[model samples]
Target: MIGIVYITAGSMENASEIARELVVRRLAACVNMFPTFSIYRWEEKVEEQNEIVLLVKTDSSRLDEIIGTVKHLHTYSLPAIEFWEVKGEEEYLDWVHVNSS
Candidate 1:
């Protein structure tokens, strides 16, 4: 089965760098970027910020490696990294699994 991971980079440059590495290392089949506005509580204070959201596509087998790679390249002490299993059509999941390699 395949899955989709969501991660946010500290900046555009970092996002691009990580995306390239993921693809080169065969950790992800694709990485998409979109403008994002986030509002959340940090350090007991609510803050709003503009950021770039990365939609990462890869097989489940590569999940841990991909996460580790992101953590290593990420700037924040704690980066926003989350994954959601792809409960989609069979064909699509297979495609993700195939291309991720």
Candidate 2:
């Protein structure tokens, strides 16, 4: 199965670093990032901040390793990591599987 993982970083630099590591390790096929404003409750207080969001494409088999790598490299005490099953063009999905392997 293919998985699309989502993660947010405090800065573009951090996001790029994480993406590079993942791709280099073959844990992710590709990573797309963009800056956005995030509003959420933390420490019992609502806070809003600008953050970079990463969209990682990889194989489900490597999900655990990808998460661990992100945690190891992330700057956040508790980074937000989420994944969803995705269906798309067969060629694209196959590409993700081959690259992520």
Candidate 3:
């Protein structure tokens, strides 16, 4: 199992849209969305804003397909998408593998 983190705009509508697509397509076992704050510079202008963060759980082998789909569907030209290798207790990992598969 693998845990993927994605940062999207603060819009619930956008988060919901992404969540639905990933889950329905079986690319993700579960997606957890929570509020987050982001500070960055764009187009030579600095900006600070609240954002929605998504924690997507899926099988490790499916990461590429999922990423490709996101790149194709994401509104932003360079969406912040990353994956964290989940190295933890065996039981939890097993559960994630089961659920994602």
TM-score per candidate, chains pooled: 0.90, 0.98, 0.82
lDDT of 2 by residue, 1-101 (tens): 99899999999999999999999999999999999999999999999999999999999999999999999999999999999999999999999999999
Off by over 4 Å in 1: none
lDDT of 2: 0.96
lDDT of 3 by residue, 1-101 (tens): 56665647457677778777888888887889988888999889998988788888777887887788777777678778888877777877666667666
Clashing pairs in 1: none
Q: Write the per-residue lDDT of candidate 1 for residues 1-101, one digit (tens) a residue.
A: 57788998768998898889998898888999988888988899998888888999998889889989999998877888888887888887777778787
Give the candidate order by descending lDDT.
Answer: 2, 1, 3
Model 3 clash tally?
A: 0
* TM-score, structure 1 vs. true: 0.90
Off by over 4 Å in 2: none
Each candidate's clash count? 0, 0, 0
Best by TM-score: 2
Residue pairs clashing, model 2:
none
Best by lDDT: 2
Comparison by lDDT, 1 against 2, better one: 2
